[model samples]
Target: MLPPELPPLPALTRAEGELIDRYLEVLDLLGRINPARNSGTYTGLRAAQALVTKAAALRDALTVMHNRGESELHGETLARALRVLDGERRAGLVTVPPPADN
Candidate 1:
């Protein structure tokens, strides 16, 4: 059987697109660095190190938006965009997992 169709992504300004992309990048790095999720210090350390750069890029995306006079965040629209981008799953990786059943 054919897979279910996915919803289309919301229309976004160039800066907003960059913002979402950068934010997801940071989220991914954080997930990798999450101690509860990771077993190796070296892997977490690498993700932690990369977190600094990804965070900076996220900052830059926001700064660009501000400079361009996009002051307000459209939460509803962005939330849709994030959902379309699998953000829920990506974000879940950063959170502490539920207790394991014995």
Candidate 2:
């Protein structure tokens, strides 16, 4: 995730918050999945297990970035968060470009 602005608020809209919430839910689902299952039902879980790593990384990065001053984040660092958010959408954990315009 990109380094958050110095204040670390990120000015997220409600839609953006919802998207983040969805991604969290997906991550939770992945956490619930077990790696030892030998059945086909475990396939998606296995996939989730692998994919959740990205989400976990994003979560950690965001936590760190948010601790920074609001003005500290710019360009490349901010881009990283955008990329991770996009990855969340691509992974079907969240929706992209939120429906309502901010």
Candidate 3:
């Protein structure tokens, strides 16, 4: 479930919305990148995964900034993204940190 503190997306500008879409695309692309863990690993793919994660965080932060009513949106989205990435990680599609201690 989305964070209740998250304000609606109505306040986002067209460009901002586009950025969010781009971030989602990045995530999709990340899923497509082969980890190639067999032969020395694909550092490029891992790098792309990190880049996409950072992009998503930026998108969420911008969304929250545009709508302060959902001050926790960025954190919430990051958490959800991490969960989705967990599935990807388990499938050997990407490598990220272990789940948060909390």
Candidate 4:
């Protein structure tokens, strides 16, 4: 089974919404590659996979909702974290953290 869907983040502006779409596109393209934010392990693999899967789900959800009029196309808060991660990736920082082996 797939992971649970996350609560949608509403885009507050057209600019932000567009940014979110761009960000999701980037994720769908690149989120699968493990950024190796921690020591390589099973946890890192899962985290990387989760990043790609969840992002693709959320991206699809947003697109469908926008098409169905269930949600705004431009949610300001949507993809805010993604914007941050985008910045971090551009800055050569870790994007996905491995789950703690507890």
Candidate 5:
């Protein structure tokens, strides 16, 4: 069954909304790779897993910071994480672009 739709959130600024979108993009890219099942060549998969895990950790950290009213720090932290992913993308490791317009 489909979940019920709710009203839009009031707390999320456009910047935060974009970051959330980026988070989904990152997850989608990682989900396409079967990290656990790929046994033939584990090294690249493991690195990708590590990259996604670290990105997720940064997202989680931003959530905590936002909840604590210290959301000012989220932009820089998320940018750093996105920058790392952008480097990987430029190296042809992933497809999602970093938060370019932000």
Candidate 6:
């Protein structure tokens, strides 16, 4: 069966798009590094190492936006964009999971 069509991405400025993309990348790395979620130290360590680079990229994205005079954040619009990009699920992975039942 054909999968349902995904919603179109919300309109965003170039910097905003970069910011979202970089932010998601960082979230993915964080999720992998999350001790509660990760099973192995080596895996988490690798993610932690990669996180430094991803975080720098995220910072650069924001810096570009700031330099471009995009001072105020459009929270509602960006929230929509994040939702479209599955930010909630990605971000959730960074959190500690619930305790297992006995």
Q: How many residue pairs clash in each candidate at the backbone level?
A: 0, 7, 0, 7, 0, 0
| lDDT for 62 (candidate 3) | 65
Candidate 6 whole-model C-alpha lDDT, 0 to 1: 0.93
Poorest 10 consecutive residues of model 5 by lDDT? 87-96
- Where is model 6 poorest over a 10-residue stretch in terms of lDDT? 3-12
**lDDT tens digits, residue span 1-102, model 3:** 765553333444444445455555555545455444323346556656677676777677567656755443454554454444343344444454356798
State the C-alpha lDDT per candidate: 0.95, 0.49, 0.52, 0.53, 0.53, 0.93
Model 5 clash count equals 0
**TM-score of every candidate:** 0.95, 0.30, 0.31, 0.33, 0.32, 0.96
Which regions of candidate 2 deviate over 4 angstroms? 1-40, 71-102
Per-residue lDDT of model 4, residues 1-102, tens digit only: 997665555435554455455555545434334455444566566666667666766577567657766554433354454554454454333355547899
* Candidate 2 minimal-lDDT segment of 10 residues: 89-98
Candidate 2 pairs with clashing backbones: 2-81, 5-69, 5-70, 6-69, 6-70, 6-71, 7-70
Better of 2 and 3 by lDDT: 3
Model 6, 1-102: lDDT tens digits are 998887889899999999999999999999998999899999999999999999999999999999988998899889899998999999999999999999
Give the Cα-based TM-score of candidate 2 against the true structure. 0.30
What value of lDDT does candidate 1 attain over all alpha carbons? 0.95
Best by lDDT: 1
Q: Against the true structure, candidate 5 has what lDDT?
A: 0.53
User: Which residue runs does candidate 6 get wrong by more than 4 Å?
Assistant: none
Candidate 5, clashing residue pairs?
A: none
> Which run of 10 residues does model 4 get worst, by summed lDDT?
85-94
lDDT of 4 at 43: 53
Best by TM-score: 6
